[model samples]
Target: MWDLAGTLPLPLGVLDREGSTVIVGLNGLRLLRDGAWKRARAEAGA
Candidate 1:
């Protein structure tokens, strides 16, 4: 997740590479604002 200000990258949860799974709660996901996500994705060219 990213902060609403889009200046910091917040830790949303954990990822298990071997298991190919991500552990994130609903609240954590909600912490990410749409604008921040869109800005980040655009910057990353994703």
Candidate 2:
């Protein structure tokens, strides 16, 4: 995730495991959401 943000030059704020305190760029959020969705779908299929 950090790597993705780095490549995209996305802004970020890390507070903890939860993202409630985090601030991210639109592209970053989209990428993160897509990654999470893919992971969840794979796990579900497994």
Candidate 3:
């Protein structure tokens, strides 16, 4: 997840492993919901 998040065009926010939550910033969340995560993973060949 961290690896995929790193590929995002915008900055992601605090990732809390203990809570198993990814607190993404507003823009990052929007992008992720818009399929940025998949695109990033594909682009990275992951």
Candidate 4:
């Protein structure tokens, strides 16, 4: 994967404003959970 440090982050409304209701509902939670899981796994591995 590339760093792309200069890349700008996408806004929350970047996705569907009406559609993807289910995805919108779970996206943030899933992202946070995955982040925590990744950190936990990385620390455990280290």
Which candidate gets the maximum TM-score versus the true structure?
Answer: 2
In candidate 2, the residue pairs with backbone N, CA or C atoms under 3 Å apart (3 or more residues apart, or in different chains) clash, namely none
Residues 1-46 of candidate 2: C-alpha lDDT, one tens digit per residue: 7655665333433343236535445446766677788988999999
Residues 1-46 of candidate 3: C-alpha lDDT, one tens digit per residue: 6556676333333334423444445445677574787887899996
Per candidate, the number of residue pairs that clash is 0, 0, 0, 0
Residue 27, model 3: lDDT of 45
Off by over 4 Å in 1: 1-31
True-structure RMSD, every candidate: 15.8, 11.9, 14.6, 11.2
Q: Indicate whether candidate 1 or candidate 4 has the larger lDDT.
A: 4
| Global local distance difference test of model 1 | 0.55
What is residue 14's positional error in candidate 2, in angstroms? 18
> What stretches of model 2 exceed 4 Å from their correct place?
1-32
Comparing 1 and 2 by lDDT, which wins?
A: 2
- lDDT for model 3 comes to 0.56
Model 2 RMSD in angstroms: 11.9
Q: What is the Å distance of residue 1 in model 2 from its true position?
A: 35
Error of 1 at 39 (Å): 0.1
**Model 3 misplaced regions, further than 4 Å:** 1-25
> lDDT per prediction?
0.55, 0.59, 0.56, 0.64
For model 4 the TM-score comes to 0.30
Q: For candidate 4, lDDT tens digit of each residue in 1-46?
A: 1225634345534443445876777876775777788998999999
